[model samples]
Target: MNSLVLVLVAIVFFIVAYSTYGSWLCKKWGIDPKRPTPAHTRTDGVDYVPAKAPVLLGHHFSSIAGAGPIVGPIAAAVFGWLPVMLWIIIGSIFFGGVHDMGALFASIRHDGKSIGEVIHVNMGDTGKKLFSWFAWLSLLLVIAAFTSICAATFVKVPSAATSSLLFILLAIIFGFLVYRRGAGLGISSVIGVALLFFCIWLGLEFPLHLSYNTWVVILLAYIAVASVTPVWILLQPRDYLNSFLLYAMLLGGVLGVLIKHPKIQLPAVTSFNLGNYKLLFPILFVTVACGAISGFHSLVGSGTTSKQLDNEKDVKVIGYGSMLIEGVLATLAIITAAYIGQDKLAELLKGSATNVFSNGLGEFMTGFGLPFATGKSFVALAISAFALTSLDTATRLGRFIFQEMFDKRKSADEVSSNPLTNKYVATIITVVLGGLLTFKGWRTIWPVFGSANQLLAALALLSLAVFLKRQGKEYRMASIPTVFMFLVTLFALVLLIIGKMSNFGKNWPIILIAVVLFVLAIILMITGVKALSDNKVSEDKNFKA
Candidate 1:
């Protein structure tokens, strides 16, 4: 298979999906351009300020497009490129896009509330409380895993570490210029991009050398500040700036594929079992978690993006459209892995997916007339940017979860009103806990993180199904995906539990965490099922009336 053909096919499929099915979903969901979003109505300057569609899209895409999309496809490529590509295309259109759009719609309808609050509206208080804690823990796992991953990158690759630090500084300056000085977007963006490239050059020349442990502490400290700062101050602008680098890499890779027309050297289908591992049904589903459907996107949709949404009509674009873009990135990742060859991929697979992606992406960039070392450094910086965006976003979302959990019994006006459970307190607690979890190592946290992420997506889909049912709208769109993800993720959890129990003494901590996640998932599923049943009964009664 020619990589160019794969790239073209994926691009056409995504465009068709976005134009037809995405538009259909928007219409069916009744998107109203005239509707005032929370950003307009709530306008708190802190969390609910309206943003232009492009800017919000940048933040939303960058935050959600973390290493997961890159890593999942690369890791799951062992099942062969065909399986990975098929899942990315079909799943993005049907599952991931719908899940993300529904989440955003639910949150906006509820005045920028987190999905946990959405659960409360549809599934009752008990369900809300359970889901809230589940979401918080899932976010903590995200923060921990991403922080460790970024820290490791910084420790191992001094250029990436230096570039990332400079990126943060540049974000703050960019934010100040744009938000405070009222600078023009075009001018500020050009300057920001120029400075970023300079930093990349500087980082290569003067790299930062830090131990892994030190890097972890510094990264967590950065998260602490970034998560608590006003969205416009750091989070939004930083993501917007980082997004340029991401887009460049995506475009560069696509063009590289087109120019080089690399032959796909990897097999199209391998054994369902790889060594001691099985690449069959549920494992492939879980292994390819993010590229197809990620629960974390829901967190981002409801937790942060909803608050900044300027128009109801933009939800389809930001939520559904961004997901399709990720699907494309995932496809590119599959191509990168395939081009790396099975032998080298097997070796790289032993380490972080960042290694595989950077190396392969370096080769791709070389086709564009760049030195492999420089291209590798650039790719490494982009990966670091991706991880950092996800890190702070997860932290911010975790804060929202904590505040909601603490404020459960209160009225909407009083929620998070108490200083004790305020944003600052909640953020600090969330970051500290996540920092502790980071010490457990990314290798230890990733499996559970991936499973928990997919499980959360299942739960979010169920919440959306119930929301649609209450609206007297067609809900099979959400419900069917909900059921599928639920089963797949539940099966994955069971397998993890069995594996963990078998190594109980050596992995007791992880085993305990896995058990808790399993229990929570089972409870949440039961709650969702009951909610659907109750909604049906109510609809029947109303029909009789």
Candidate 2:
């Protein structure tokens, strides 16, 4: 077997081990699935009720598994596959997994409030405010990124864009039927997958021609509605459908590599050079988040997900398992593109890696009884649909974090607490901002998000480390990985900032944005020092049902 096949096999084994062992640990922790979640316990029932396990996982995965995982790994593959591969495995196992699991466990134990709430309660008001800024900014970057990626893909592939529109409509129809209509998950999932494939077929048979502006309008409208809808309605159903697409892409991508048997073969390691922008450890870390550790995981873990825990024991699966799936996805992407030839990858996938991914997957799926044209088109549209779904979720999450950041400056009525209102305003603001900024033809803006995201990763990891420290028994055991990842991420982000600053110079729109973030990152890091010495803290609950 080639290196790609071996790497894939190893990833599969690790995922199984982690999920199974993590589940076992949950039972060992005495987590109970029977008790009401904090959302339900604290709910007036309009919203904030605890979710079913699958539903919660769907929300979490959809929110966190955005273009980051797809884009980060692919872009960082420039640093050669070894470092990316190493980080993906080690980070998921020790760093990212731990960060995600820790945030989740902490939030659940505290109540289904956000990480911001937990920060205030345990780390103090100052810590909460600073971390909240990091959280909101991190999510905003997500909105800009995934939105741009989707917009670009829609513009490039009109047929796929139309297919995506159909699939999303189908997702909503089934979402309402299965979730809102009390139809079973199994039935809904099956039907949802079927509809997606049919849309793919339809796209091939009769391509729709949507202009770039027209598609953007459609994308924005879909996001506005989907963001506020209940998890069961749009988020869960669509994500469930998207998950199958992702899996098919994964399977097909792997098969393509196997059939092609190409290799990166670009030498075991490449030198760290980006001209005068020396890419030391910092650049490596910041530019390569999802493959390694991402701060964004904390938001999702603490956001809608913690409310839906079937049992405290399931964190490993939802948190760690979802990340593992992403890692596998990234690895497959690496093999597919690298094996195909890097120059061709840069040519074909340039600015539209999702298209190349879907294209490759389409070719692979064609052998599985799917028509060639239909499969290729299906592959493109499936990714676009997923990206659009993530754009909506990320916007809502950003809005939630933004509004929740500061102390109440006004009465509750004065504040916009309605998710619908918040989502609409947030999406418009971000899309408008993103559209305006990139309209100047900027690739620099793209990496600003990467830097900001890595900084967020540092903050979330620090919080996770703090949580572990407070757990007396677990503290000692967790300290090593916590400290190691903390330092590595910190170093990586610093490099990202330096690179951005150097790359953009004084007129650097994105560099200025990133520098501000780096300062905030430092302040938050200082806040951690205070958290360490300030022994007076809230009661950290046992995360059992």
Candidate 3:
């Protein structure tokens, strides 16, 4: 199969799905344009500030995109492109779209509370606490994994490190201009994006070199500050501006494929099993997370995006729309591996999936007259920037989850006598724990992270289903995905634990963590079942809101 034709077909299918199926979902759930969102209702200058549709989409998309789409698809390519492609398309439309959209909708209706709060409403305080602990732990894994990935990338391509830092300073200035000085979004965005490209060039000219360990510490420190600062100053503007890099990368990749028309060199089906440790069923679903559905997306939807949402009408575009866009990126990633063939991909995997993806994208850019070295560097910079975005965002979400464990009704900035409830204390504690795991490196954390991430999606879906049931809304869309993800994640976790047990002394910590996660999943399942069995519909006046 030709890469161009395959990509074009996927793009067309996504557009159709967005228009037809996505719209149908919007109608079924009743999106009210007139409804004032939590961003307006909460009106906190820090996290709850209302953002324009485009800007919010940028933050949401950048945070969720990270390296998952690139890394997961490329890593999972051993199963062959055909199965991976089918899952990306099918999963995004039905599974991921529904999961993301539902979480956003549920959070907005719950006064922009996290998913833990959603569970609190339908289930009880105990369920809320359990879910919050589970979520915070999962986020720690996210922070550690992305931090290691970004730091290593910085060591590999020092130019990306330079550009990434420049991107942050630019975001701060952009935020000040647009928010403080009351500049227009239109002109500011035009100038911001233009300057962003220039930064990429400057990065290439003057690369910043740092050791891997040094880079990890610096990245951790950066996220610590990024998580605590006001969103507009750093998180929002940086992610918003950085999203353009991703957009350009996507456009270049598509155009390159169109011009090059590379043949898919990998077989359509490799085997159901890759080795003694790998299998097709659960592993594929767990590995290809962000491109399809991720539990992490639910945290993002509820934690930050829900607070920044300007209107309920933008939900479909920012929520479901972003997932579809990522699906396209993931498709391109798998194509890169397929184009390289199995043996070459194996060699690339020995180094990193980011290498495989960037090189593939770099080669594609050559078809459009860009030098491979420059294009490769550009692609490298883009992924590293997004990885940094995810690192900080995960830290922020971790802070939110930890603080919410004590109190869900109030924002982190609100006054609380308990030291644990203080935002500063919460942020520090979260970062320290996540940072401790960072030294362990992403390679060790990634397997368990994948399983934990998918389990999170399952749990989030279950919570959404319970919320919908209480409101007497159509919920099979959420419930069906919940069941499927639960099966996939549970099986994957059990297998992972069993596999690790062979090296009991070396892998005991991982086994312990995985075992705890398994217990959490079982407990959440019981709680969700009880909630679903309840015949009493919630009469909360907010449901109508």
Candidate 4:
């Protein structure tokens, strides 16, 4: 009915274009995303990347989607549907999608190490270390917030505990089948994915509860075990299984939307109240990445996903295309969100299902074939799935980064000098620290995920644009996007910082804390860039990610 709404529609169309157009460009350049892949490039187990586009896309999407899509919209909803929706469409096309695709292509082009490694080679180690530090901190916030989310849910729905165990055990068994046994990837993934559904069904049928403390411990234990295990055995299979779970949610969501056809009721513009906006520019960027742009996408791009490329040609599908799918999911969430009254939405979000997203999606799923009572629990489980998927992936990626930051320059052979150290110890260290924080409580840590996430997105995109600009021929296409992202994000972060400063004396501890973090983040980011610029490499020709 309004111009803004039309803008929203156009934005979505542009995102669809953003996802496909760049891929076409890459294809034109003769890039093959499916080449032997860096995972196979120098795999000794730890960095064993998958070469299949679909599989890696599954892994990347699951890891990146955690909490963002659900939480960001809810936060943005306060600002009204228009601003949030606009950002979602525009950010994804120019900011998130391009950043993700660029990072993926960058990593695949270089031998699949990480954004940190790439920066180190191009920018320098200090540059790498700075980004790495931010990355690890970002992940810690993620684990802490999500772990607390899971712990809190387990506290409420005790029966869900059994399902958690079921997932972990099932994932491990599935992992073994794929990694250790002679099981084919397709067949093993099929069985593994089926079991994931079975676990969810059982979780609903036989709910279990535990003390918040015990639940925290149990989840941490799972994280500890899950992180150290090789990707083939655990990460891959669980992620593979997670892929199915999410798709199921998508299927159920689409059908529910079609069948329910609920009416939209939220105001076109959320009241222009800047005070209640808990996060500032940078933090807002982080908080809203699920719907807009996300730094986590960059992490996944460089982490394990980059190594799996069978052909660089597929980068568009995996990186940009997968992000577009995530946007659609966020869109679906928003559509369902449009159904309930604001007061009712607020009430539902606060009660259970963790955040607005879980509650919204939970409600949406029930519209399909699920029972009402079970809907909330289903919502909780879905949130847990998202949290776990992010938690593990973030931890492993963080560890690799931490090690890379400190590890000395060495030949590729010497790089693996301590393979066990990277896979097991680093992962454990990351999980344990995060688990401890989660045990403390999510309410204490959750608010920060948005800020950290946005900060990383800002930095990563900048790095990507800079990297692209130096590519000469490629820079023509990338230049506009890169420069645009830099300006937009920089503006956003500046607004973010200003907002945070205003919140400095707020009564709300969380907002106050967020404000402080914003200051530090800005300083850290500046130093990181300068350090990178001063890297030993004068030409920026060599890169590691």
Candidate 5:
């Protein structure tokens, strides 16, 4: 089959779903344009400032896009393009879109509270505490794994290291100009983007040389500061700037596929085995978590985006629309991986999934008459940008969860109410823990992180279902997705525990953490199920009246 056909099909499916099912969801949930969003109702100016639709969408997309969509789809290509394509298309529509929209909607209705607090409103204080801890732990794993990945990329790719440093410097300057110096978004964005391209060129001309460990330390320190700062100053502007590069890369990939029209070299469906494990039923679900459906996205949705949402109607576009875009990216990733020959794909798979994407992207760019070196640098900058945006976002999210864990009132002021829960202190602690974990063993952390991420998604869905049920709104959309994610993620957790136990001597720490996650997931599931059942009974009684 031609890879272009797959791309076209995925694009059509996403567009139709966005227009039809996405609209249906909006109407079913009764989205009101006149409704005052949290950004308007609770304008803290720190976190809850009302952002323009385009800017908020850019921030939301960059935060969630990360490396997951690229990595997961490329890595899962061993199962063949057809299966991966189906999952990305179907999962984005029925699962990821609904989960993200529901999360954003729930948070806005609850004054920009995190999903854990949303859980609290529906399921009570105990459930809230448990969900908060679960979210925090999942974020810790994200910080650990993503920090190490970024560090390794810098060490391995000198040009990327140089470009990354320049990117951060440019973001700081851009933030100051826009937030303090009174520069317009139009002028600042143009200047920022122009400088970014120059950095890319400079990086190619004079690459940075740093040891892997040193890069890790630098990244951790950066996140510590970035996470605690006001969102507008760093997170929002940086994400908006980074998103342009991502959009260009996506567009370039699509054009390359169209021009080259490469044939799909990999099988349509292969055996279930992937390395030591099998890709049957639930394993594929776990492996392809980000591209199809991710729990981490719920964190991004409810964590920061909800607070910055300017309008209620924009939630569908930011939450559901961005997810569909990610699905498109995942489809392109699958096509990219498949286009590369089997031997090269296998070799690249031995390293980072980013390598496969970079190589495939380089090949695609060459078809457009660009030099391979230039193409490689573009890919590096794009991936580095993705990782960096996710790093600070996760750090900030971890801070939110930590602060909320202690403050029962769930007030926005609690973020700085005390030294212990102060934003700066919380961010430092989160980064320190994540950095230490990364230094100890990021490799061992990866497996558990993947499972924990999906498990969080399941928990977020359950929380959303409960929220919807209490409102007497249509909740089957959230409930069905919740059950599917819960079972798959739980299965993955058990397998991870069993695998860890088998290597107990060398992996005792990971084993313990895996068990903790498994137990926590079970407890949350129980709480969610009970809450759901109770809500159903109450709804029935109200209907009988």
Candidate 6:
């Protein structure tokens, strides 16, 4: 099979799905453009400022796109391209798109509060508290793991470090120009993107070198400030400009595939077992993680994206559209592994999934007149940039969840004067804890991130379904996806617990955390189901699912 053909087919599938299925979802859920979004209703210039569709899309996409799609798909290629590709395509269109869009819609309807608050309204305070703890902890793992990952990347390729810093400064300038000085997004974006590429080039000329530990400290400090700062000044604009890097990389990868027309060299199906005790079913789904669906996307959607949404009409495009784009990126990622064949993939995996993707993508770009070394470096820098984006965004989200936990069902703008609810204090607390875990080693924290992350998706789906049911909206779309994710994550967590029990002494903390998450999921599931069962909605309209 030609890789280019696969790319073309996936693109068509996404476009059609977005136009038809995605649109149908919005209509069924009753998206009203006339209804003021939370951003407009609660404009604070901090987290609740209304954003143009393009800028919000960029921020939302950048926050969620991170290394997950690239790393997860490439790593899961162990199950072979057939299963990985199948899951990415099918899962994204139905599971991920609906989950992402639904979470965003649910949050906006609740005045842009998180899924936790949605749970509060529908399922009760107990479910809300549990979900908040679970979500905040999961995001802590995200901050820890991505912090370490980004730091290691900086230490390995100092040029990425230089460019990443330059990117931040560039975002600040762009934000000020567009927001403060009334510069138009069009002209500013053109200049901003031009400067973005310049940062990459300059990074190559003057690479910044720092120790791994030093880079870790610097990154922790960066996120501490970045997460607490207003959205427009840094987070939103940085993400907006950084999105162009991703767009460029995607364009390069797609054009390169077209020009090279590489054959899919890997076998369509490796054995289901892969010679490990891990079965193909749950492990494959878990390993693919964000490539197919992720719980973390719900956090990004409801946590940040919903707050900045300008209009209800943009929900489908920003929420569902971004997920489909991620699906395509995941498809392209798996294609990188497939094009390289199993032997090379195994070798590259020995280093990192990032290596496999960069090397493979670099080779692809050579067909388009790019030097392999430069192209490889460019790909590496782009990955690091995105990983950094996810890092700070996770930190900010952790802050939101933490503050919300103390707010007692209040909307985002109505936090009390409790010391714990202070944004700066919350951000510092989140970053400090994450930094401690980073020092402990991302390798230790990462083992359970997948299960915890997917579990989050299950919980978010549960919350969304319950919210929709309580509101007399069509929720069957969330039903199967909800049940499926719950099954997958629970299965994965159980397997993880049993496996970790072998090394009980060293792995007790992980076991304990997993057990807590497992119990939380069970409790939340029961609560959500009970809430739905108790609802008085007509059986004909809402009970069929």
lDDT of 3 by residue, 1-545 (tens): 89987898889989999999899888878788888899998897999999999999999999999999898888888898988999999999999988999899999999998999999988888889899999999998999999999998999999999999999999999999998999999999999999999999999999999999999889878888888899989988999999999999999999999999899999998999987568998999899888798999999999999999998999999999999999999999999999989889999888799999999999999998999999999999999999999889999999888887876345546677778877889989998888888887887888899999999999999999999888888889888988999999999999899899989998887798899999999999999989988886886786672
Per-residue alpha-carbon lDDT of candidate 5 for residues 281-341, written as tens digits (9 for 90 to 100): 6667777778988888888989899999888889889999999999988988888788776
TM-score of 1: 0.96
Candidate 3, residue 330: the lDDT equals 95
Indicate whether candidate 1 or candidate 5 has the larger TM-score: 1
Candidate with the greatest lDDT versus the true structure: 3
TM-scores of the models, in the given order? 0.96, 0.87, 0.98, 0.85, 0.95, 0.96
The C-alpha RMSD of each candidate to the native structure, in angstroms, is 2.7, 3.6, 1.4, 4.4, 2.8, 2.8
lDDT of 2 at 412: 40
Worst 10 residues of 5 by lDDT: 536-545
> Evaluated with TM-score, which candidate comes out highest?
3
lDDT of 2 at 296: 73
What local lDDT does model 6 show for residue 534? 77
Q: Which stretches of candidate 3 lie over 4 Å from their true place?
A: 408-414
lDDT of each: 0.87, 0.64, 0.91, 0.65, 0.83, 0.89
**Candidate number that wins on TM-score, 2 or 4:** 2
Better of 1 and 2 by lDDT: 1
lDDT of 6 by residue, 375-439 (tens): 98899899999999999999999999998888753453564778998888999899998888787
* Candidate 1 Cα lDDT to native: 0.87
Off by over 4 Å in 1: 275-277, 412-420, 536-545
Clashes of each: 0, 2, 0, 30, 1, 1
